[model samples]
Target: ACKKILISQRYRLQAMSLIHESLSYSTTYEKVDMSQYIKGIANNIQKYTHHTIVLDLEPCVLGMSDAMNLGLFLNEAISNASEHAYAKEVKGRIEVSLKYREEQCVLRIKDFGRGFDTNRSSHSLGLVLMEDISNFFNEGNMMIDFEEGTEIVFSFTQKKNT
Candidate 1:
């Protein structure tokens, strides 16, 4: 129980850090390209996991606030996959894809590693953060599919004025 609490606290700290970084990047909200930001996060995660990260990002733009929240969501999901998804002997693969359609942005992060039960309560903190962030956008929501591995999909509106 203590370990779970500690882990939850750590995730909270990471979410706060992501929010701070995004706020520091821009004052007034505007549509900004998110390719570089996603790449940067992937790069950072790859270094620690020594795993392959594949990115398929379309030319999508997002408001500063939305970007920050999404960044936080991705960070938690990716980190969870890297840390827990793979067996010690297996080299993991994490694929991230982003596409925009009809004023909505769809982001998918899939990991080729062992999957977990989304209904479990042990990993609620990260899941809660992702869900909360997704709520910020119009018609925003998240879904997790566990087949061979874990696939997390987040869909949200790209309305800049919001």
Candidate 2:
């Protein structure tokens, strides 16, 4: 129970840190450079997991709310991958990519470790929260593939600026 509480606190801290970093780098405080935001997240996760994280991020900007929601979604997904995907003594590789094209964004997180049963995790709080976050995006959709490891793909259309 204590360990679970510590992990929960750590996750909250990570979310706060990401928000602070995003706001610090924004000029208008309404938009966030997602590439930079994701890099910061990847760096933090890498340090904690000591796993190889390869990133392929395209430069993209998103509204503050969308960025925050997506960042939280990412935090949950990546944290899940790091915790559940690998063995204790094995250093695994995780790949993250964010691409924006034709007014749509696709974010992919893949881990080269043993995958878990998605059905068993469907009721987990982390997965439930991630699903909720994805709903905030315009036409947002999330898919998880367990073959060859666990790969989570989330895509959404960007909201048009009025």
Candidate 3:
């Protein structure tokens, strides 16, 4: 099972790496202040179309190790929403939140848009990749709420940098 997960993640990471490479110049960074940059990204996306972007950031913080994990976690979540949420002329509402749970950290990104069938959602390349990445992140749980709107929640713990 672990091998399967790793293989899936490897494929997804390969695609992400290629996408990162194709960009002539990159705007995103490896590490960032959650409050500062999160808001910036929301503002930029909000500018293009009339979408309600919210940054529900908490004062809680994490170390570089944990932060990096959360960054990738959030990146994948937001990227998924940005790519496939299909809002037509208006952009979807995206909400990013960070909070510490005991010794762990939880980061969540939610999108209000067209929802997909969880059971029917094809274990496409992206979903497979997300599953693999979620496994590596330690107790990281993901769920898709497919009622009125689409919401993807990812909750995980952070390991401190040595």
Best by TM-score: 2
Worst 10 residues of 3 by lDDT: 17-26
Off by over 4 Å in 3: 1-32, 40-50, 117-120, 159-162
Every model's TM-score: 0.79, 0.91, 0.61
Each candidate: RMSD:
3.5, 2.0, 8.1
- Alpha-carbon lDDT of model 1: 0.76
Error of 3 at 59 (Å): 3.0
The Cα local distance difference test for each model comes to 0.76, 0.85, 0.57
lDDT of 3 at 108: 68
Report the C-alpha lDDT of model 1 over 68-129, residue by residue, as the tens digit: 77778888888878777898788889999998787878999999787986668346777877
Q: List the residue pairs that clash in candidate 2.
A: none
Model 1 misplaced regions, further than 4 Å: 1-29, 119-123, 160-162
Ranking by TM-score: 2, 1, 3
Of 2 and 3, which scores higher on lDDT?
2
The per-candidate count of clashes, in order, stands at 0, 0, 0
